[model samples]
Target chain A: MSHGYQAVGWSPFKKRYDLVLGGLLAGYLALFSLATLLLRPEITAETLLIRAFGTAALLLLHAVLAIGPLARLDGRFLPLLYNRRHLGVTMFLAALVHGALATFQFHALGDAPPLVSLLASNTRLDSLSQFPFQQLGLAALLILFLMAATSHDFWLAQLTAPVWKALHMGVYLAYALIVAHVALGALQDERSPLLAGALGAGVVAIAGLHLAAGRREAALDRERRAAGADGFVEVCGVDEIAEGRARVVTLGGERVAVFRYEGRLSALSNVCRHQNGPLGEGRIVDGCVTCPWHGYQYLPASGASPPPFSERVPTFRVRVVDRRVFVDPRPLPAGTPVAPAVVSESGGGG
Target chain B: MTPLDVATWIVRLAGAYAAAGLLFALLFLFVLRGVDRIDPSARAGSRGFRWIVLPGVAALWPLLLRRWLAGASEPPEESNAHRRAAAGGRG
Candidate 1:
């Protein structure tokens, strides 16, 4: 809750977070520069900066990508997810510096403009061994610049969350571009096993984390599908859903959150409207289903945000028979009001 | 035209577009209403927020225009009880 945005809604926590980040970044650059100067004294200062910033940006990008899956796997990593936009912006700046230095070093003072020079300097598009890796890097940088520019809440609001999310998914494309950029550009020039191994490990770590998290989510979906039948899916017994908690069931390829609150059962789409957050993982706060990711709330019965907030999610029809909860797999339109099923006195204790 | 000239022209055009976009974004921030729907905490007259989001709006103006034209910023209406009943409402 901000009533008005400042440059940033900085808190003590953010200040400390930024300070630690800056310290680590400065330390990495310094160590990298020192090592380069000592070990490879023949390397030019410009080359040194390029390599240092490029590697730093690559590492930061890895950290940025890792934070999402890490937070999903462990709650302790949620703090990193909170201020991730800042991390992304910083990574872009580092990448920008690397791009600037590289362009100046390689393409400046030529007959053609730097952009033209970059494109034409190496037209070896036909061969993988001699591919124009700089162009790949430039493409990735453009994507980063776009993402960095829009890494703000205002854009999220302006573009709508779904559209904004889809746009940012371009990061994956940018990441692939960068991997090719490195493999065909820097790694080709320098045949260092250590550098190649680090890049491979980073790719493996990112891929492995995403796979693990996806498998976990898939297993939950499998369990739900195995228990249900036909269009009406049997979720669980009323007693299984604790008061103010929910049991998430996957029906018809979508996750539905069946929540029990005040001895009433209601089901709504599991995806949070704000960031596609898991609503089932969140508890009902103030008579609304609050997303654990950003605390955006929606009324369980109507799937509407409380007055003054405009977000909504699809609601599902739920009924209780002999303490077993059954949900209609077909979803009603977002914000559709559905009646809550009242729990019988003999059903379960709240 | 040679490949070099074509590439140079493309770069120049891109630069011009970026400059025009920045100007348009500034105008949109100052002149338009109902543009800032994502952050309720953002004050309508906050120059700080405007400056922060200017670059993003410039880069993504087309997407923003589509959203604005589609009336995506408007708040969702509360469904009436009769309408809810028609949709198979339990309540």
Candidate 2:
């Protein structure tokens, strides 16, 4: 919500989320240390720290990447999506530690500056097997650092939702660079079949989850409904939308959420003003459509955030004809308050 | 030129850019916090928020610098399918 800017809007839930995240990170490090010591007792402390943090960061990155699609596929994962930025920033911090330690170990003592040495150390662009994968890791780290820096709502507001989203979409690039880094750099050096298998599994899991979620969205978008003479596309029946719930339909090449509240119907753009979350998936809360991602609320009729906040989504004129809800595919300007269509006992024109 | 020379030049250029960006980021953060305002969100914050946004500001200083110089105030409205249709007929 654009109510006001705070350093951090921490609550009990957020604190608990961070605590769990911290505990998981600590547990992973401890387990990794124990396993490394048991298997390779001659491994140096620096190498152990580097490997532990690097692998932990990669694992956390996978979780952060999967959470978006997982939430779309199942409502049970919505809670994870809320404070996912915390996980992202934490992941970046771990990656930073790994990068810093690696840089110090390999490049810091060179005559050239650390970054210059990192970039020029092995410029074997001609040979695929001898590619400078460290450069790829450095590039990914920069992207992650930028994302972590701008993870706050202030950046969202300053850069606008679309720009902020596009900037953060660099994560996919980061992930690809990281995959190449691991495949070419670490796996090549170690030649560990187990490590190679784990990497393959991580890639498969990420790709599989994303594909499933994308297919679901594509199917929803492919759901075509014909418009009536009045230019209203029939979405669903009144009974189809439960009380305080919405029926999402693709209309006018965009998804619209038709909500039935207090025996009336109102349709608005499915995209939330914050982060473009799926408003259709979120339920009505306290007389406002609360965005599941961040709980940003908007009046269903007006498609505007309740006072003291300024977020708005495009509204559509909705009417109920013979108990069937119809929405004007042409969206009204954002924050345009439209009269709610009524559903009567006899199912008259509403 | 060899790949090593290319890498060296690229690294040197990037290092220079980063140094200039850090200076600009300092000016943007501490000195020009009150002026060169992009939004009220930028204005309405303490030191904590500034530090959080420091790296981003440093990376994106040129764009922010342009915006600040142009006297841009409010964040622009982002247009998408919904907004494009809402502005006029569905196109």
State every prediction's TM-score relative to the real structure.
Answer: 0.86, 0.95
Q: In model 2, which runs have C-alpha deviations exceeding 4 angstroms? A: A345-349, B1-4, B34-36, B89-91
Question: Which candidate ranks first by TM-score, i.e. highest?
Answer: 2
Task: Output the number of the DockQ-best candidate.
Answer: 2
Instruction: Tell me the docking grade of candidate 2.
Output: medium
| lDDT, residue B53, model 1 | 81
lDDT tens digits, residues A178-285, model 2?
A: 999999888887856999999999999999999999999899999888888889888888888988889999887788999888878899999887888889888899
Per-residue CA lDDT of model 1 for B1-91, tens digit only, reads 7767777888989898888778768766767743565334554437877888888878877766665567664423333222243356332
In Å, what is the interface RMSD of model 2? 2.1
How well docked is model 2, in DockQ terms?
A: 0.58
lDDT of 2: 0.87
Interface RMSD of 1: 6.7
